[model samples]
Target: MKKSIKNLFYFCLPLLIIYVGLEIFLHSLDYEPKTKNEYLEKNKNNLEILILGASQTERAINPEFLDFNSINLAASSQGIYPNFCLFKYFAPKLPKLKIVVLGMPFNAPNTPKEYTSPIVNHLNLAFYNVNTFGRATMPQDYLLFHSNQDYFSSRIQNYFRDGNYSNLNKFGYDTTRFYGAYQAANYNIGKINKSEIHIENEHNSKAIHNNARYLKKIIRSCKERNIKVVLYSSPTHFLYNEMRDTNLVYERDSLVKNLMEEYENLYFFNDEDNSGFEADLFYNANHLNPIGAKKASSNLKTFISKIIDNPKSF
Candidate 1:
């Protein structure tokens, strides 16, 4: 029994040492947390509109177009979960907040279950504390060495390889034209030979329910503070629409319609159905080029003006 105990100690000693070493390294690096502290410090008081969602919303929304101060908290490949986490973090800080525009993409339902990367969670924890980490919609794997190690390694490699993480906010964003409009050209209606929306129908229904829940949370939070919440569907190429037309897209639209009916404060603007534009305006099936973005922005401005002018009509 003494020999067995001795053997166990020997086996566990290296792992314990390694774990301590890693924890010290992670705390020292100060890379995972990114500029969350700076973000909080800068925008705590000045921010008026908060945009949240995946890359599309990040790339699409030009805060300069609006009259109020806005910040794009959108991250690549993220969805409702991160958005919720961010809202919970910033909502208290932004007491003067007027609007929260949430971008709902058709593909949001297809997001994986383990969507929250460890690095992101770690950063969130460091900036927002353990409560925020616990509030993450994903399961906690904070103690998993493999998970944390992988996250740390990837973040370090990315920092050295990219040379600078600040590039993410360089121009910040431009209102002159949509930044990624060219990506939309891949889905021109005239060029399309095949038309089939590939997204799963059942999953789409689930996504819509998830979206409704997400919207409800945002709406409730905003209502408590007298902030307006608007749900806007950004424009996608006709081909992308063809893709979304699959089972999931239909269910998502139906769900949005249901939500619109149920909530007086929730508004849905269907840019996809808006007429008066040619197919060439699209950069691809999922985005609008510069021209399309301008037109879309104009349409949005008009819609917003009307809404602001007469909130009761909406």
Candidate 2:
């Protein structure tokens, strides 16, 4: 029995060494969570604007084009929960944070729970020490090496097999493929896989309530800090807008308008229509290409310039 035990221990030693090495390698990459957290920690005093949201915001807002000192925390599949968590974690540290820009497109009200992408929860906890998982974040979530085998393995493979270290720019904007989600959402959205972005065509009462709870938390946090909260709807192609359920759109618009009335610090800028962002500017039915991001950033600059201080003018 002693000889058998000794043989087993020797067999597992090399496997353990390889596992630890891979863990360190995966954590060392310039993922958005790690780099963005580092950036925010280093520049907490100078951040005037902190933009948070999912894919639509990722495609539209580029901080370099803005006049203020800003950082884009948006990424693909990031919902309101993660946005709120990130804001809550960093709000206290940012002395110069005047505004929080949230990317709230037409379907934003339908942001489902974090279980839709549990890896997001783990990513937040592992990198930024922010908890988007609420009560579901387990101690095991911290052990990314063991808990998320496929996700980490894919990242490892991507890093080694092809040298694809990261898709994020220095500003944390994901310079990756953005059209797949919007393209899949263009036709027969009902049949498209719901894993990527939130473009549900039907009215979901639960999703609306869940998302609203977090949205209100973010607004109230900003209210307490005396920071302005700007929630804007990014431009969507006419085809995408036309395909959406009109009633759902109306309900979402009404929800946002109602919240705006309730919260004095809350402001909304809607660019969901073709307002100069015609077919030529879109990468797909929802996301913008490089040219459109420039145009969108310029348009956003004009709007934000007007509302820098006066609420009445806006």
By TM-score, the best candidate is 2
Q: Give the per-residue lDDT digits (tens) of candidate 1, residues 116-225.
A: 45555555555555333334344443433344666667756765797444433322542333333333334344545444323322363454466567667888878778
Q: How would you encode candidate 2's per-residue C-alpha lDDT over 260-279 as one tens digit per residue?
A: 98999888888888568865
State the lDDT at 71 in candidate 1. Answer: 66
The prediction achieving the highest lDDT against the true structure is 2
TM-scores of the candidates in the order shown: 0.67, 0.85
RMSD of each: 5.6, 4.1
Distance (Å) between predicted and true CA of 62, model 1? 3.1
Clashing pairs for model 1 are: 184-283, 184-284, 185-283, 185-284, 186-284, 187-284, 197-243, 201-248, 237-285
lDDT of 2 at 150: 86
- Model 1 scores a TM of 0.67
User: Where is the poorest 10-residue window by lDDT in model 1?
Assistant: 167-176
